[model samples]
Target chain A: MKWKLLFELFVVFFKIGPISFGGGYAMIPLIEREIIDKKKWIRSEEVSEVFAIAGTAPGAIAVNAAIFIGYRLAGFLGALAAMIGVLLPTTAIVMLLGSLYFLFKDNALVEGAFLGIRAAVVGLITYAGIKVARTSIIDKPTFILFFLILLSLLFLHLNPILAIFIGALAGILTMTAKKKIQQKREEKTHFQNKQIREISK
Target chain B: MILINLSLLFLFIGVISFGGGFAMIPVIEAEVTKRGWLTTSEYTDIIAVAGMAPGSIASNSATLVGYHVAGVPGAIVSSIAITFPSLILILLIAVSFNKINQSPLFHSIFYGLRPIVTGLILFAAIKFAISNGLIASTFSWQMVILLSIFALSLFVLLYYKAHPVLVILASGIVGAVIFS
Candidate 1:
């Protein structure tokens, strides 16, 4: 039974590996359908949460999502199974194509095909950006933060790692301040209620 | 020596690539060019190949570069190195996920991080568009065709909600017909 589950995990991700073109976010809906709708392995909400965690993790979003799902379903070995499965098809295809590309580097047909694919990739990236922004830029603070990071990256040419660090630090400070202000308001309301009670008495 | 360098470089790229595959391009280009493995034009070719090929562009580029520098072993090593850090980190996160998710600090960090990641992705898109000549200093029919393709792709993705693989396949066909 254990071996079967591991094999199942591998098969599921192997199926996803090839068709997951355009990048990691493109794989999310497919993963949702497979894991939630078809397999009944996890619920819809759980999948979204997994996507959130995957987005924040250090690797490719697809790989991270696969690992989280695999680990949840089985354990460490399952995660290993899923990771390899997800990577295997793409690796094989890339190796084969890489060799062929070197041999036919000057081919017009290949070059023309890439000319179109590259433009489509730009579209793919833009779509991904819009999808992420829809979920992420929900409030005034987040909207401003988005523009700030964008401008810094475009003009100042800040490192992405530094930007992430600044975002984290800024988040912590702003959230802490908001919490403190909320607490102060609660305390003031409590004191006012006590004074009103005493006067009535 | 090349193998060691490739592994270490990609491993570092993997750890620092918080925004995902597209965001890794600038760093990868800088390192690969600095190391003298591939020339600037060749590196651009690799990016194009990686984008066209199946898999993450980051991993695909690393594998190709590895193969170019060393051999099959280099490819395996680089690929493994690129993916290793994330596997370890994700496993740790998976194990302690409940604890992390429950923390207000974690929530706040993600709240800020999400928009930043979005910006990074947008930056990557714009960079790619300019480099690929989809956006150029002077306009041409090629630019018009590419823009139309981009618009069609975006429409199909957002409205029709077509699978990306299908979109890529269709775009390849469109290229073959128009450019060829």
Candidate 2:
């Protein structure tokens, strides 16, 4: 049973590893389907939690998820198995593809294929951008921040890192203000309720 | 000497890569271009290949850059080295996830990072768009078709929840048909 579990970890991450085009987030649905939904290796809610952990936890999210999932399934050994399985395919493929790519360096068809790939990649990146915005930008402040950032980037051609730094500072301030407001409201409620309780007693 | 240099270079890449592979672009570009390790076109070709290949773009890009610089050994060393820091950081953080998952301060930090990441993606997208003719002076029917494809793909992705791979394949077919 242990060996079979290890095999399952190996096979699942191995399958996801090479086939994960468009990087970390792009593989989310596929990984969710295979591991959580179909295989029942993990629960749907667990997968979402894993994704959240993966994002904030560091490393590549996909690799992190594989390691966690593997650990969940078969413990430490399973994690090693899964990580190796996932990375092996990509390493092997990159080695082969990189070597062979130079052979067709002058081929126009290859050029065209890459050109098409580039255009498609732009679409993919743009789609990812919109999805990110919808999920992250909720309140008016955040929305306005996003719009201003977009305008600054699109027209002013400001550096993104600077914009991000500004946004981070804004977030800190907003969160601090919101926390203070909530604390004050709670205090006011407590005081009023205390007065009311005294009168009743 | 060469292997050591390559490994160290990739290790640096892994550590500083806060926003993943695409964000590593300018840094890697600077290194390769300044060093004359690869031509500009070669670097762009590598970017395209990394985009198509599996795994993290940063890892894959590291692999390609390494391969071009020093062949198979270079690829191995660089990929492993570049991925090492994040891998270690994640493993350590994974152990503490349950304890720290609900911190407001943590959420706020991410909220801060998200817009920055969005800005980076936006900047990258615009650069790609211009390079690929998303905004151009030339107005061919092909341009119109490409724009429509891009617009439709974004719509499907945002509204219809279409899978990225499917969208990519569809775009490829459309490109082959129209461009050919």
- Estimated TM-score for each candidate: 0.81, 0.76
- Judge candidate 1 at residue A112 and give its lDDT: 74
Which residue ranges in model 1 land beyond 4 Å of their true spot? A1-12, A22-56, A69-75, A184-201, B19-22, B25-54, B68-71
Error of 1 at A142 (Å): 1.6
- Assign candidate 1 its CAPRI class: medium
lDDT digits (tens) for residues A145-173 of candidate 2: 77787687668866554665676687888
lDDT of 1 by residue, A26-50 (tens): 7988988888899898898787778
Clashing pairs in 2: none
| Candidate no. 2 TM-score | 0.76
Give the lowest summed-lDDT range of ten residues in model 1 chain A: A105-114
Candidate 2: list runs displaced more than 4 Å: A1-12, A23-46, A71-78, A144-170, A181-201, B1-47, B137-146, B155-180
Record all residue pairs in model 1 with backbone atoms less than 3 Å apart, i.e. clashing.
none
TM-score for the first chain of model 2? 0.67
lDDT of each: 0.81, 0.72
